[model samples]
Target: MKHENAKYLRPQHLSGLELVRDICCGNLEGGSVGSTEVTLTPGKIKAGNHTADPQTAGSVGLLLQVSLPCALYADGPSELCLKGGTNADMAPQIDYTIKVFKPIVEKFGVHFNCDLRMRGYYPKGGGEVVAKVSPVSELSPVNMTERGTISKIYGRSFVAGVLPYKLAKDMATTATRVIRREIKDLYINIHTLQEKDMACGSGNGIIIIAESSTGCIFAGSALGKKGVYPDKVGFEAAEMLLRNIRHNGCVDEFLQDQLILFMALANGISRIRTGPVTLHTKTAIHVAEQLTQAKFTVTKADDENASNDTYIIECQGVGVTNPHF
Candidate 1:
């Protein structure tokens, strides 16, 4: 299938390892996957209700992340019902996405409302989320050159099913202790939630969010695994947040890549100063450049006061307008 607009071209197809070989050899013809098929006809995106159930116990945050941008192109408001693991390992927790990730994108003019109907964990996947997305005519460029003082830090330490409530309390206490060493006057408020009613399975995790005076937010998290102690999880999350603050970057490490696409769509130039560039950030830059046919530049920070890992990314946006396909 093919979707074409002045801003981008989307070739929707299924592929496997063989498809990689074909692309490497410059063969443009498509390959097949399963019998599942889709037929596309040219038309404006219509407002409607959509349901997605990713049968696997994969992270619902991953599914929502991929689908949110597409929803913004709809001609009218869109409502989505998603089901899967709400707090699975190796993916951004749903709480972080809603509180941290969504707000960052909102700075660029994306509008959406989400509610977690039920919490899902690993091994048994039955989580439900509802999101309402509104279409936008255009996205604004974001200039986050400075991340001012860290005014406050807040977090949630939650446990569900069989875990003891003390686990969550201990996590909050441990994390607060670690953060106070760096910022003597810092206000760290960690809430503890131990609920047997909301979760689909047994799990515990902590999500920390740091708010800057300039409205930039940096978040860090740690999940509890089978053998990991609750205190260790709390300590790790605090350490991660401290590391990001020490680097003096505008956003946390993981968020740098997430903003690339929005930056490419904005009007005029968009610049971001961030910590060490990861492969994910590099890949996002490549993908944005390829899809929008725009230019992005990466430069290392030369200031003696800056950390060696500091880098600056600049991009010339295509000025994606409303009524985009």
Candidate 2:
């Protein structure tokens, strides 16, 4: 769909689908998402190499979020060559999508692998990523009401283009120091890196993650801005992660919404424990309900020791299967 106000977007690639306009949205001067037309073929959308060029610093991660689900039900597998921002200010960072979202989505039985080929920053966007998704005939439901043990804490602080590598190291050092002060007995490792090749524009960002033994993942991230101290960025990211840890939910707030569609499409009942419901999650739930026959319920979790912020999201999926698969 091409809107007057929308930026560029990549079309979903399925075996049986035909498309004239791929995810090539507007130029640097963004536009709205007013779709003019759509065409379809006999099988699922034709799966193959596709590209999404937002021209501006639009999000490649957002492109995947819109297309990956459709690819799962495709006639075959899909390989996407996405180009745009890897670490946008508004969308999920590429790292969070890979590290946190990928694991949780795989639990539903579909699998995909992503490799960042280049680091794309805001304004003049020139990042690239290659993602391969394996088609699944049916999806399995998930159960993750318990947060379980926090097995590990790890992160990465990255700098690219004209950004100094010292900034990355500074962010990592400060974040490690902050987290260690709170939890003393876990393996804490935050790596600092300088993007050596094909890094578009100067940029820096930090991501901190906590992985639960039960497969739940939570994360916090902070982007480096002009005039902001690297140490302050690290402190902010650590604090964001710590706040999620304090929630004690099975999943992070951001993860809550992303799973709604999968839960609605899975084979059985799916349940998860999460922190406060985000507006994005609510919107996803509404969209899922409108598009599928799935039923969803949101209620407070029955844990006396838990804080008031904890809640349970349960979905009765329609057990939809791929007809072409």
Candidate 3:
């Protein structure tokens, strides 16, 4: 079957799963298994919904990461009902996409929403999410230079399917305690969710976010495992967020990498103060510089306590516009 806006479908092998990417002109589609389909339309990328289900449990969050940005330059608004794993090992979860990613992008005029219909976990792979995207004429530059005072910290701990509600509560409580120990007077609120039968597969996870006065956000997350105690999961996530904040970065390490391509595509100078640049960010910068005419520079922060751990990233955008739309 052919899709109107569809461009091509090529098979890919990863983690012992044979899959196909239903790539469109403007964006790359991470499709599920099955197909020799490839067609390229020489025009604007039209919006369309895709299903990546059946036997493969692909990462819906990964799909969104690639899809939403391209959709911003699409011919029109896009709606996607992506199916596969909502929570898996080594990929961003749906909650992170909503709580952390979506809010940060709004600062740059990118608007999108994800409505999760079902929670799909690993192996068994039955998850569904409805995502909506609105095209933008151009992306606005963002500057996050200083690590501002933290206003509040909010968190969510969820257990789905066969997992017990106690696990979710335990995770939330432990995470709250750990964060409180460090912040002292800081207020922390964490909600617990027990997804009984509403989700497709069995799994549990925790996500914690800290919001600063200057609109910067930092987060930590960890997924539940079979033998690992719930408290351990909570502690891991808490430590991750704490480490991120202690580095005195305007944004977390992961966000630094996530913003790389967006910075390159933006209209003007985009500056971000972040903790030590990760190898991921390094690779992303290299690829963006190679692909687009965007120029990027990295320099150490000038703070009295600044060491190799803190640095500033600046990007001069190529000013790519949505003329096709």
Candidate 4:
């Protein structure tokens, strides 16, 4: 008698998973694991009021397993696996996996260790699997001023489909124009993914970051299908950075020249500029209010005649406050 080979093919990279991780983790500089497995089994399919009758009646099913590297999860492993009675619903399974992982990777500091043990087929079949998890250090804090060093801008917008490249470019141009002086050394990146349109536009999200003389700034924006103007997304992000700067009382000719120093202190400081004020000026009372919840000191200039002419802000939790928590 002759035996047949099972033909075990290796799993390929899942772009969906990578995209989710990138969106969540901000930058791909954090710690990660490699070559984790994911297994799936088949389950009964309901037909209207009752379970669907099997045509053959004999055991009929399929199994699926995938292997991929851990992209995010600085603290421990995050599980990625099939759900919803994993029968033939590949699309739903994938969607659930993306939803579960996206927010987890973005909000928390955990790693992933996926494992696929058994496989299942359609028409009432089932199996079991496991995913290992571990923890790593939290990602480094990021700021917004880093945009000064960027050169090119990349923009990606996901509506029902990919928005026109021209539209994305227009948004990028607007962003640059709004903050031209603030973002020269940074590169802008934009991409649109259909996966983001999965359900009532709940999956839609935007991310913005900049690399400056100091370091990097990571920011993100998300929108549902039924709310807000999409065109304002990038502009809003730019404004947020501006507000953060103004709220911090760090907007001054001197501070701008010495951005590296302030950038280093951004994680430690809370309040920034009130608008586009300069350094060495009396800090604004608003700065005190804003930094009240942060970790930096709020400083203001006492003399109204000083040539520095900078606004004042506060840093609520410098050296002691940890944004990660």
CA lDDT scores, all candidates in order: 0.77, 0.80, 0.78, 0.32
Give me the runs in candidate 2 sitting further than 4 Å from their true place. Answer: 1-44
In the order shown, the candidates' Cα RMSDs to the true structure are 6.7, 4.7, 5.2, 19.1
Model 1 ranges with Cα > 4 A deviation: 1-44, 303-305
In angstroms, give how far residue 185 of model 1 lies from its true place: 0.9
Task: Please say which candidate is ahead in lDDT: 1 or 4.
Answer: 1
Better of 2 and 3 by lDDT: 2
- In model 1, the clashing pairs are 137-322
Tens digit per residue, CA lDDT, model 3, 68-122: 7777887777787677788877778888888887898888889988889988887
Highest lDDT against the true fold, candidate: 2
Model 4, global lDDT: 0.32
Q: Please write out the lDDT profile of model 1 over residues 1-325, one tens digit for every residue.
A: 3322343211212222122222122232323333233323323445667666655456677666666666676677878777777877878888888988899899889999888998987767678789888888878888887878899899999999898998898888889999999888977899999967777888888999999999888888888889888899999989988988787778888788888988998878888888998899899999899888768999987776468888888999998776644
lDDT of 2 by residue, 239-269 (tens): 8888887767988877888899999999999
Q: Looking at model 3, which ten-residue stretch has the lowest summed lDDT?
A: 11-20
Top model number, TM-score: 2
Winner on TM-score (1 vs 4): 1
TM-score of each: 0.85, 0.87, 0.86, 0.32
